[model samples]
Target: ALYYDNGTFFTKDLPKFQPYEQQANFEYEERFKRTEGKAPSGSARKCHFCLHRLNAGMLPACVTTCPCGAMYFGDKNNPKGLAMQLLAFNRGIRLKVSQGTEPRVYYLTSEVGTADNLKACLACHGA
Candidate 1:
């Protein structure tokens, strides 16, 4: 996510960028070496959680656009909302537990690529 901080731009993208890009390139090279090693087709665009839409009570475009029905969005305050329910029922994990930024987006622990232990999606007690 990008944020304004007194003439500076900050985002989690910087840490994630190089590793992911290099990994993608490595996979592509291994796949296409016999055919002249063309880079894999992928979008490197970064996305901030859509604050505008969230403020307007609508889900982010990516959530709605997910073709596999993998994304869920709802008011965290509503204990009955699907998102809240998921958070309650499933063990959600932060993308990076070590940083302790207390991320809002979390993955179900059952999900193969989730973190080990992290606080609530909203940093329940406090930041």
Candidate 2:
């Protein structure tokens, strides 16, 4: 799932990277043996609340990075629900979607917008 980004430059050669994937799997096992029982990815701790999804509210990075007040984040169950409102605004349009193992990140963009360029750029530029 991590290796399958549409915008990643290496997306075209992913099959050729299979051996490295196997090597990573082996390295993980070796690291586990060395550490007894610890995450091979390393020891980084996040806030407890940050670990859980809080509905369609502001995701972590968006909340932190928005310099302007353009981005809004909150629960979707409000009388003015953000998620429902946004979807309703696009009722007739198609929404491209993908299922990840457990996706905690969401991007809101349209085909005609800067988002489209971003996706294409990622595919060829290793974003």
Candidate 3:
């Protein structure tokens, strides 16, 4: 859920039982200045699940280059896929389940320290 307010871009965070948190404030103008006043297409600066790569039968860049091997991608309905196996084994949860959007993304819960560590790494690595 990326949005533009004034010249800033941000995304809303979804928690299991808490209110949505607005996270990741980024300057729209500074980030997209090269476009020279043209509006960007698609979901602004958000991920579109790498449709181009997926159509080409390749993994998304994020999944392929994840330093910690934390990301996985596969057909959700495929019983033998690693993503499905992990989701079932770990009891993965999806965001905004009540919305009935049936989002394909699933998250596996982790310790607080593990999440903090990942955040630090992403901050430094520009993920």
Q: Best lDDT goes to which candidate? A: 3
Question: Whole-model Cα lDDT per candidate?
Answer: 0.53, 0.41, 0.61
Q: Is candidate 1 or candidate 2 better by TM-score?
A: 1
Each model's TM-score?
Answer: 0.46, 0.29, 0.57
Say what the RMSD of model 2 is: 12.0
* lDDT of each residue in 1-127, candidate 2, tens digit only: 1232222323335555334332332231233221213333444423323322333343745455545433445454664777556544543232343443343223445545556556555665566
- Stretches off by above 4 angstroms in model 2 are 1-61, 68-72, 90-104, 115-126
Q: Write the per-residue lDDT of candidate 1 for residues 4-114, one digit (tens) a residue.
A: 223222333454433333342223223311111222333232345666666667888878876545668777789998888888977877787678876777776555433
Candidate 3: misplaced stretches above 4 Å? 1-34, 42-46, 110-127
Sort every candidate by TM-score, greatest first. 3, 1, 2
> Please, what are the lDDT tens digits per residue for candidate 3 over residues 44-111?
56566777677778998899887767789999779999988877767578888899987788877655
- What is the Å distance of residue 43 in model 3 from its true position? 6.5
